[model samples]
Target: MKLEDIPRLSLGFLPTPIEKLERLSTDLGISLSVKRDDFTGFGGGGNKVRKLEYLMADAVAQGVKVLITTGGHQSNHARMTAAAARKFGMKPILVLRGNRPDMYQGNLLLDHLFGAEIDFLDPDAYFTEINPRMAHHAAEAEARGEKAYIIPLGGASALGAMGYVNAVKELAEQYAAAGTATPDYIVAPVGSGGTLAGLHVGCAMFMPKTEVIGIAVTGSAVPFSERIAVMANAAAELLDYDRRWTADEIRIENDYIGPGYSIPSEAGNAAIKLAGNKEGVLLDPVYTGKAFAGIMGCVKAGSIAKGSSVLFIHCGGSPALYPFAGLLTSDLKEDQAG
Candidate 1:
């Protein structure tokens, strides 16, 4: 299956801009740039929009009338999926981990605004229960004479990863058009592994010289690396590509994850403020901020040479910032003081 032959819904603003961060580059003594997937221009603009383009296309192709997905309370994937479903005139059901919050803010608020039917579950039970619960919901919908499509967490399916694979090809074209060198490193956050896996495959095929790094925001590096390989290979097989990715191809730095998923860290908060103040780019505390912190840490540790070119894939989670206002403000105060 050639890429052009694959099913895809024209949902996001394609060929998202790749802009050089002059200020950040000057500060870090490196050539730094960012790929703004955040400007995808749908459902509050996010990287998830890319995956949904393919996932929703498949859903529509199968004559699905409803879409079901699972994720955390503030899941960008869930929020974007709901918005895409609404755009395609399909009902969306989100099986979110965590109890209903006292207040709906950020992506949670947008999920409600998009009219997604949300079913909240205990955080502990979420991992174990969400799959069965989604199946049950689909069964119920079937009984009601409705067709349903269930999307996995973060839309991390073989088809979904095609989004980022396409993104990498787009970035390569952008670089060639702009007469810029291929980045020495391409950095992104690893949540459910699809994006990173896609990047790994895409970079290998399009920008073979560039190294792809993943900042693990949710799990340990070892397991996430394995997961990425699995996802990358699966996506490759779906595309009828003969290449197979290995765990050795995945380089993930787990140090920046801090406390845990969705929990703000001092380093991540500081990185968020730094990007905002220096480059006028907003990064959410959960994913991009931590990944950027890892990038900064690599520069400070001499792991990334001063003159090497680095490109950060800003996956877009700005809405998530609203929920971390208190934590971010406090960290900003300390970051400013020292």
Candidate 2:
């Protein structure tokens, strides 16, 4: 199927600017730029907005009345899915994996403001019973004669991956308009791996010469490259795209996930401060901060060659900084000094 034939909704600001991080570029002795998906301009703005454009469009086509999805307490995907549901005149139901916090803040707070019906599950139950739980909700909604569209965790389905595939096409146009070829590297954080999968397929289709480097920000039971390959290959099959991605083909920098998902790491926090100070870019602890840290590490270790152009795909989770304020304020090196 042609990419244009795929159903998609206009849910985000298109073709986000690619700007050079002048200060950081000079400091690292490389051409460092950022693809600002952060400015997507929807539901607090993030790359998830791109995925939802396809997922929500599918929901509307199927006459879905309730949008259901699962994620961690601070899930940006859940928050944006809820916003998309409301915008499309459908109900939003979030089956979140974690205890309900005393104070709803960050994406959770916005989930409330979007009027999503939130159901919390303990970590153990979340891993083992999430499908059954979501099924139960779907059954209940069906009983009431309403159809529910259950988006996977992080909306990491093939259809959702199409969002980034299209994004890369847009990116190629931007690069062409600027009178240059694709950058040497395209970097982003890998959590549930939707964005990574999308980048794989998108680069294969549009930016064939470009390399995608995904920094793992969360430890998962399955190897991230394997998971990304599954999503990327599925997305490619949808378009009948000749290139098929394998686990070996999916490039993931696995050293940066930290202790686990959502826990702020030392390098990640430092990168957060550096981005803010150097380029006025606000990155969240969970994703982009860790990604930036990987870039810093690569530069320091001479893995990313000097003078090469690198583009950081800023996925944007700044709202998370509020909840991790204490850590964000503390100097990681100073805590060690004390």
Model 1 Cα lDDT, one tens digit per residue, 1-338: 87878988898888899889999999999999999999998998889998998888889988898899988877999999999989989999999989999999999999999999999999888777888999999999999988999999898878899999999999889989989779999999988988988898888789999999999888743498788899999999988889997788788898998899888878898899999999899999889999999999999998888999999999999999998788777756998899
lDDT of 1 at 256: 93
- Score residue 111 of candidate 2 by CA lDDT: 96
Task: Provide the overall lDDT of each model, using Cα atoms, as 2-decimal numbers.
Answer: 0.90, 0.90
Misplaced by over 4 Å in model 2 are 331-338
lDDT score, residue 38, model 2?
Answer: 92
In the range 58-148, model 2's lDDT, one tens digit per residue, is: 8999999988999888888898999999999999999998888999989999999999999999987778899999999999999999998
Poorest 10 consecutive residues by lDDT, candidate 2: 326-335
